[model samples]
Target: MGHDRIDPEGIADPVDDLYSQVVVSSGEKTIHVAGTTARDSDGLVVGETYAEQIEQTLTNVEASLAAAGADPADVVRQTIYALDCDAFVEEAYPHVVDFYGDDALPASALIGADSLADPDYLLELEVTAVLEE
Candidate 1:
């Protein structure tokens, strides 16, 4: 698999290190992970705070990626939905950086939503990954 992170000229760079402006990737297999949230196997909300919820959400995302034979480094894109975008940026950003790392960050978007499927869910993650074989 090959993944190239790009920030094209004329397009001002993103202010934060959470993502790249563009991601060019090639691989033999592609994986799409459905929207994942901070829910446990028993179907209960996992956290009361943004930090805790984001961590559980990422854990869920990792499990989904592993089930598909992929990992965080293979991810090329992500969509993040948060109940409170500001709180997510302030409290949950570190967990995100820790999950993907600065070097392996993917093209991403963080959206603020009025609510989630479960009222207790604080965030959701959708990811796309590629595998070499």
Candidate 2:
């Protein structure tokens, strides 16, 4: 038997993306993964840059959706939050492709925020997925 991993060489941290992602799921299930902020499992905001937090939070979202038996395509809706909206949309937003293929995306809404759960929490994404039976 062999092991397979997701995007190993891409992310510098080398940590299993699933550390904050879902690898498998099943059945007709409706899962509500709580809105995940950039805050780490320890509940500490991870970065000062919107890009940093956005990246981590999105990773968590991918995992959570997978755990719910959904893929990026399974997501029917999404919402993104940013402290300084313009900066992210112009700069980091392009990276969204990393979350769910840049070319193919689900219905989504973005908001310019004054702040999030934490000041360092520059960006966060919440999604809804329906697991097909």
Best prediction by lDDT: 1
Model 1: which residue pairs collide? none
Model 2, residue 117: distance off in Å is 1.7
lDDT of 1 by residue, 50-125 (tens): 9999888999999999998998999999999998998999999889889988888899999999998988888899
Error of 1 at 79 (Å): 0.5
Whole-model Cα lDDT of every candidate shown, in order: 0.90, 0.63
Candidate 2 is scored at a TM of 0.70
lDDT of 1 at 51: 94
If scored against the real structure, what TM-score would every candidate get? 0.96, 0.70
Task: Report the C-alpha lDDT of model 2 over 1-133, residue by residue, as the tens digit.
Answer: 1111233445453122212222232336555667788777787777777677777787788878877666765564567887777877766666665666533354556788887776557787887665655
lDDT of 1: 0.90
lDDT, residue 12, model 2? 55
Query: Which residue pairs show collisions in model 2?
Result: 21-63, 22-63
Looking at model 1, residue 95 earns an lDDT score of 93
Q: lDDT score, residue 126, model 1?
A: 96
Displacement of residue 129 (Cα, Å) in model 1 is 0.4
